[model samples]
Target: MNKPLIAGLLTLALAGCASSQPDQPFSLTVAHINDTHSHFDPSDVQLTLNNKTVYTRVGGHPRLLSYANQLHQQAAQTEQPFLLLHAGDAWQGSGYFKLNEGAMNVDLLNQLPLDAMVLGNHEFDLNNQRLSDFIDGVTFPIVAANLDVSQDSDLQAVENLTPYVLYAFKGDKKKRVNSVEDAGKYPVVAIMGLVLEDMANIAPNIGQAQFKQELVSAQQTVDTLTEQGVKHIIALTHLGLDKDQQLAEQVNGIDVIVGGHSHSLLGDFSQLGWEKNAPYAQQFTNPDGLGISCVVQAGKFAQAMGELTVNFTLDGQVTDCKGTNTLLVDKVFYNDVRRADKHRLTDTEQERITGFLAKQPNVALVDEDPGLRTYIDETYRPELLQTYGAVIGHVPSSLQHVRVPVANQGSQVAPLVAASQLYWANTPEVRGVSGREVDFALVAAGAVRNNIEAGELKAGHVGLDILPFVNAVSLVSLTGREVAGLLLETINGAIGDDTHAGQFPYVSGLRYTFNETRRGHGYLANIEYLHQGEWQRIIPDARYQVVLTGYHASGNDGWHTLFEAQQAETDRIDLAYVQDELTAFLVSRLSKNEQGAIEVHYQKQALDCQLPGVSCNADAQAFIDYVQARRPILTALPESGVTVNRLH
Candidate 1:
């Protein structure tokens, strides 16, 4: 949407204004949210005191809307222009996204007065056709400067999709500020969008849609905007916070960046009892040393809304930047006390506590908008419950699926998940079709989002928590050397010195000992494979069949060796979803006459020690054996299945 009249008028003002003239201050509020991940209903956020869980219920979309609307109204009253920006990924995650394929998210988003939105990588999860349809229905502009959709006619035709859009911020009317007549009064803001450069690897179904590097594309867009006399430029980015920072440091002519992905929390985290970062509006010096750019991101899942107030000079350089990342709390949250400590709060005491919280100044608590609440409760909640409420299976004990390293124990759910994938891949039906057996299976730690809680597991749990994305399992061939190298790289690069990493590989039909204290590839040693009932050291030249999700198969997470492997055969098994496959494997272990209880336990095996103050071993063997046995009866989990060693 280019405006020739506005461009011409702005150019004339720029030419006439003297360089020696005093810099005039122009202020505007940028209210932004990112990576909502479809938590339409109020989800529980644990409130902890001194590392102990105290309260649970906290954020949701309704509360986000209320807080954002309040900010908008305040800006209007003060005669200050404000822009509401959403930095993508409004699709996937919750039951609502699964039920409506992002329609519900779009509906709710339509209700909000959004200025612009960017395309997140997850937006392509539904494939090109559905994405086009979703784009067609949107009211505001969906801009992405780096996306190259030239080969896809359908995507090119989507009306709402664009590379960039210009926003003209006329001075506040209440302040008696004139519009076009006062040439230098208003500022023209150019907002450009940039998605992650690795969209092709992230979502393969986004056919022919390529992405340019964020730094290059952002600079090009900024240069063009500046050439057009647009001084105020904001990069609406789906690039994660780290990349956004890099962009700010490298790119010139950009005044601000609103970002998503990586789900980073960037603000005063202490108010929420969380770790803090560099304020809500963090400024980065430009590489050219000309000016600084402000970068901000609202935490994911609508938990917090970011408010950035930027004051720019008449020449478009940022004079001052300040704002808050307010955590949204509901009124009920005020009354939520520790369950064990409830006896300490008498009726009168509870009332006084609630009153005290209600009266606290600067504590943001916004009541859910009635219309939005009704829309969710009456229209969407019932459908979500009906579809995802069916019982799928049962968990005998709480599965500890958190991603962390214990002093001497590894991941809890990762090994089990990898074993499940291997079990399904080796079935007669699957093996016969490909005429090849799976030597091992691998899963990225990030694939498992939430732990399977103890008690009755529902279909919704499988859909939303277990396998949130529609990733398929695929079979690929790699040499034993490549496999070993993959593991080494994973531990060295993914895990490294970090206590927990999403790229950590969980495997089946294979075992290895990793010395955390050792440097580089030497950290991994004593690699072995179970071949024909015997554990033998892997031969560097031997080729082995492997099963993994399409995400890893494409070399997304530093697994380029697998991606470069010989294409001997590729099969996309038409089994149920990954979660369903996991359910099937668990269900098959139950006998008709017996109740089902999937047991899980951890054990450790000593192989060898290499580095100082560290032992090397394989702990996944018990988990591998448990799945391989397919026991019809399991009253309780084994005492020791896999032991993890946490490196300090």
Candidate 2:
């Protein structure tokens, strides 16, 4: 738990010239990005500057490449060893990947000058065959030392995919370039991939692949490389930042760890109105207590790059690790893009905002690489346009998502997402399979993605933006006590620390209050189920059918209680893909586009003005109710049931 050394300008170089002794520290710049998630094009970001919230686009693969190329050139000119690495999850979450799958990710990621990349859990989303094709397709090495792919022949046959890669920066550049050469002439850095050890639950379609324990694999790899005369070692990992810290604390001889999968943005973004976040390029003490291991990860969705200059002693201990988590953004700014407002920011305002931004070293105004942008627009975007062009639904306001939210509302979208699962489960076709009506639905906070703006929600947006993972909805039978336990654990995970917050639960037809000061199951209180327009307290022994995704059912993320409940039961039925249900929920239940509710007078004869204090939000009240059995009024957003009384 030592204070991490980062967010600084490096002022010193190697103790003189590069030498083979512990006296002269080896200084190298390691540039990294993680959880890119197929964002080849820029995405919208809202920033606050000079007391105004301005909308601007930020972070694309093209822009990321453009910056990395510049860094690479700068390092080359100085003869400093520079390595650009991706810590996995370059697939899913965009239309490009939806249509092309791993094919598109391979094509675009291959374009980057990536030295090494680990395998993220999403890489196994399409099973081993497709993942094998992607690995073979990529030009760079795919490193995952702990992944046992020997049982799967297709993955086993991939040439460039290996446990670790050795880089001989001081060796002859022209000799056996991609692999090692002249090993005796210079010390080398061994970069190995260490992925999440559990495979069955996270990626069920993993197909004959098994992952060894992360710490064991890391220690073994470090030992093997050390025996081979390698002084420097880096573990390119898909484990989240918390896990990375754990790895740093548990192991010895690892100089650095580049990590992904948590979608965590480190460093300060107070200038952009973002609350304080985790520190970037944090350092942890190795198990030996004498060595320093620096752990760094770039923010998710290619939004930023992590640049760490590690000064390592000849014995492989890090002397200094200093760097910045730079946010990549465009120069354009606006008041709001949702209303298609173009001229909201005046010239004076723009100048003032620009002046404020110029002072922050972490914020950079840059342009995309022209070639990559053109390819994205011409080759990939048109197909996505054809696939997801039509508008399916309209929103009243922007629904923001936070994996761990504060105050009364846990998340704006996760509850809605859970409601969708419940709706999909009760569909006649699915209910027939289950042989019973589902009582409620559940979704992990991680399962919901994207801050849906107040505008048209398109057909393509459902799969490509939110709920991008491939998971099927299932009906699981659980006692009320079991349900309470499941929710408490997920809340505790989110509240405990900076790790595994993605497991926070959002449920439909149920309400619960959380107290931060309490311990174990006592953290939750007033647990109730919405039954026939009444909130009834849950009975401990009563059986209820819960609808959720296969991932939750498998005990992935932090929903281990559900997995244990499943293990004890025999009556569980899988209904449909979670995204399909989410899409239906938006279109059928939430949208007001089809036959306006005011026009149809759907809510009530008195214009549905029931709550005395609150005015009827027009857009909220005016949603289409085309489906039968839609009993309760659609627009009345249920008062937030999950209230946080004492969260820090």
Runs in model 1 lying further than 4 Å from the true structure? 1-23, 50-52, 171-185, 333-363, 390-443, 446-458, 468-503, 507-513, 516-520, 525-648
Tens digit of lDDT per residue, candidate 2, span 455-550?
455656765677666464556678989988888888888766445778888778888887888433237757998888898999999998887775
lDDT of each: 0.65, 0.71
Highest lDDT scorer: 2
TM-scores of the candidates are: 0.68, 0.73
List pairs with backbone clashes in candidate 2. none
Q: How many residue pairs clash in each candidate?
A: 11, 0
- Across residues 1-648, which tens digit of lDDT does each residue of candidate 1 receive? 111122354455554543332346678789899988887866544443334333434457878777777876687678686788999999877778877887887788877777789999889988788888888777778989999888886697777888888765544321111122233444556678999887876764787787888888889888876665667888999989899899989998889999999677776455345666766678999999988899999877787788888998777789879887766765543223322344244566445444644553324666887878888999899987886665544444345554434553555666666776677677675565445688877887777775554334455665466656545455666777888778766666655453336667766777777666643334554777778988788889987777777566656666655544533332322222221222111111111124532121112222112434331111122222333356222123332122234343
Q: Per-residue lDDT for 394 in model 2?
A: 51
